[model samples]
Target: MKEGIHPNYREVCFVDLSNGFKFVTRSCANTKEMIEMEDGRKLPLFKLDTSSESHPFYTGTQKSVDTMGGRVEKFRNRFARSVK
Candidate 1:
């Protein structure tokens, strides 16, 4: 509720560097590159590695760990032996 004490919040475009995907959202972050979007306006383009389009958790492409597999089970068995 204070005035003149907050970072500038404006519409900015987030560009996924790996896949060349672009989306616009409000951000207080800074960037040096600017690109013209489909709307015909130049927005500050921030390159990122992971976004909702490519992130494992959001896209549901997560790599499942084999917790019940051979190596893990062997480790657990060894730990149980050490404890006993």
Candidate 2:
């Protein structure tokens, strides 16, 4: 990789808005916001609507689609008259 052609990869803070969970990691993502850390250091802050902390899959709050009571039944009912 060329020296000047590469983006600056540095430590940034990612904050989960829903749960207020924060962690520092290296990233090349651009951010215009800054957040002060515990040690009185400021870093680029990236805010996320949903992360692993509040995500349905990770939190085990995922809901299954009830096709049997929804579109599937409606589709069958609509087409059943045409088939018969």
Candidate 3:
């Protein structure tokens, strides 16, 4: 709220690498590169490694972990046989 003490909040564009999706929003984060939007507006292009669009929680494309495999599963099976 002070003079020149607040960060500049401006409209920026975020691009998801995996999905190649683009979205416009306001942000105070800095970026080294930018791109022009369809509205003839210069938007700071921010490259994010992950976003909700491509994330497993939002997209519902999650992979399950198989614990019953490999050396651990074999050891467990052997141990159970020994116990019995």
Best by lDDT: 2
Which regions of candidate 3 deviate over 4 angstroms? 66-78, 82-84
Model 3 superposed RMSD (Cα): 3.8
Off by over 4 Å in 1: 69-73, 76-84
Compute the lDDT of residue 21 as modeled in candidate 3.
Answer: 90
| Candidate 3 lDDT tens digits, 1-84 | 579988889999999999889999999989989898888998889998889998997888887677578888788888996775
Residue 24 of model 2 has an lDDT of: 95
Go through the candidates in order and give each one's C-alpha lDDT: 0.87, 0.93, 0.88
Clashing pairs in 2: none
lDDT of 2 by residue, 30-74 (tens): 999999999998999999999999999999999987746788788
What is the TM-score of each predicted model, taking all chains together?
0.76, 0.76, 0.71
